[model samples]
Each structure stands twice: as C-alpha cells, then as structure tokens.
Target: MSTLPQIEPTGATGEVAELLAEVKKNMGAVPNLVKVMAGSPALLKGWLALSGALSDGVLAPAIRERLAIATAEFNSCEYCLSAHTYVAAKVAKVEATELEAARDAKSADPRAAALLALSDAIIRGHGKVDRTVLADARTAGVTDGEIIEIVGNLALNILTNYLNNVADTDNEWPLVKPRTHS
Candidate 1:
C-alpha cells in the first residue's frame, strides 16, 4: 500500500543498480524501504553511507536495534518496527523479552534503561532532553562516545520512520504490529 513504487535491483540502472546490488549483498535482499528510496538515487546512496558508517560506532548492534525499535514505536512506523524487530532478533540475537521491552522503550539493563529513558525524553522533548536527563545518562555509564552514537542512531531511525510514514513503505520483513494501549 505504498504510495511509491518499489524498484527491483535488477531493473535499476547505473548508480542505483550498483547501490541496490551492495544492499542485496549486505542484507541478503533489497528491503522494500530501500526499493522505494531508490526513486531518489542520492537518498539511496546517502542512506547506505550513513548506515554503513554507523556499523562500527561505539554502540553494540543490539543496542542500536533497541534504539531503532523504540524510536520506531514512538513514531508509529510499522515498517521500521517490523524490520528492526526482525533484525534485533535474528541478526543481533536480542532476547524476545528484550525485544518487547525495546518496543516499549524500556530496558532491563541499568545502563540500557538510562539510555532508553534519555531517548524517550529526547523524542518527547523534540530533541531537547533536559540537562538532568543527560547527566543521569552519564551517571549510568553512558560514555560521551556512546551518547553521540545514541543521538546518531536516533536521527537515523527518525529518518527511516519519516520515510516510511511519508512513502507508506510496504513491509518486506516479518510484520511487527504496533502495540495497542487501551
């Protein structure tokens, strides 16, 4: 039900084709979001570069996925929620309960819990988390490097969330239905 068409890697030409190939090679498939983003070659390349750059950041894969899940949940992006949930469980090896906790923006680990709380505060405060929250995160063992990476991860997830929302990106991964709170 996406407003944009998903481009098949084989059908793409030039840079787009090259980028799609790399994506497939790395991801084992061209996710629907990437396909839709292929409509803008620059976006496709930039997204890939940003994602690649973050792969070696201070944060662990599980932590990154956790942040992604929480951010996606906050944004109500079903596509991202579904995709990251799959990534978290399969690629990152996050526990099922941890995955659920991430989607709820809560973590059992003390440091992770502090970081998640800060993430929520940032989201709710429109990226202006108060001084006390940041200090609390530092006290919880979140280093400066990790804090920077956390912000980067948040920005990345927000970009994907916005793209999925605007494009109505179709889910190509196992579907993760949004949590309903009555």
Candidate 2:
C-alpha cells in the first residue's frame, strides 16, 4: 500500500485533472508515480515540465533510460526500476543485455559506459564525483553539454526514486526489483 494516496484520474479535478489528462494522452495511461505526484499539482507540473525538457536534450533516449535504471537500482526504488525498465525496452528499444548492464552502471558502448560510471559515482558520492571519472567521461567523448544533461537526468531520476521509495508507491508496470538494497 502507498503511504500517499494515489489520486485516481476519475476523481481528480482542476489542475490535477488537466495534468492527469496530459499524462494519459502522452503515455496512454497515467502511471502511479504521476497519480501520487498529483497530490501536489505543483510537483506534478514540475516533473512534467522537466521530463518534457529533458526529452529534447542532448542525451539520447536510451542513455536517459539507462541513467534512470542505474539510479533506480542504486536507490533501491522498485517502482522506478520497473517503470524505467519497461520504457527502456518498449520505447527506447534498448537491448536486453544493455538493460541488464545498466543496473550495474555499465555498458558495452565506451561512451555509454563512461556516462554510467559517472552516474554511479555521482550517486555513491552524493554529487562529489572524483575528477578521474569526469576526465574518463570526457575521454570517452562525453561533451560538456552531455555532462550537464547527465546531471539533469540524474536529478530527475533521483527525485522519482526518492519519492517512490518514500511513498512505497505501487508499481503498475512489470516489476523489476533491485539486485541489492542499501
């Protein structure tokens, strides 16, 4: 059970209703995360806005999804892990091996591996990543723009991961649990 109420789209009104409608139209369904976020219209709106902006960012959709998976695993947020796993496969078309690799903050692609390593470092170090990781990322052709976007993506995923963990949010997608819990 969720610690927070999962606002049903049918029961929502005003801004909440409109936001849910937009989410449904875009995603074909209003996920539990958005439903829970609907409790605070401001939060829902901000999440939507940031998510929308990031979709148009420099990082590829696959990379963004990988980052989400890595963050979800590190935070032990099953809701985010499941949701991002579904999105990574169905929407991003990431390979199954790649999806599994992401959970470990790794990739077969050198650039992607570098990004994942940086993401892992950021999560483990609490934003105080070592210079060598940044240097390695740049060596792997991760541009300054991509690096900034990586931080943005990490922030976005961490927000959802922390929220889901706190709320014990119900997972609507196919469940994907973390390999280890902190």
- Model 2 C-alpha lDDT per residue in residues 91-154, reported as the tens digit of each score: 9999999999999999999989989998888889988988898998888888999888888998
Top candidate on TM-score is 2
Number of clashing residue pairs in every model?
Answer: 0, 0
Error of 1 at 157 (Å): 0.6
Model 2, C-alpha of 161: deviation from truth (Å): 0.6
lDDT of 1 by residue, 11-52 (tens): 999988988999999988898999999999998888888888
Best by lDDT: 2
TM-score of each: 0.95, 0.97
In candidate 2, position 116 carries an lDDT of 93
| Candidate 1 weakest lDDT stretch, 10 residues | 173-182
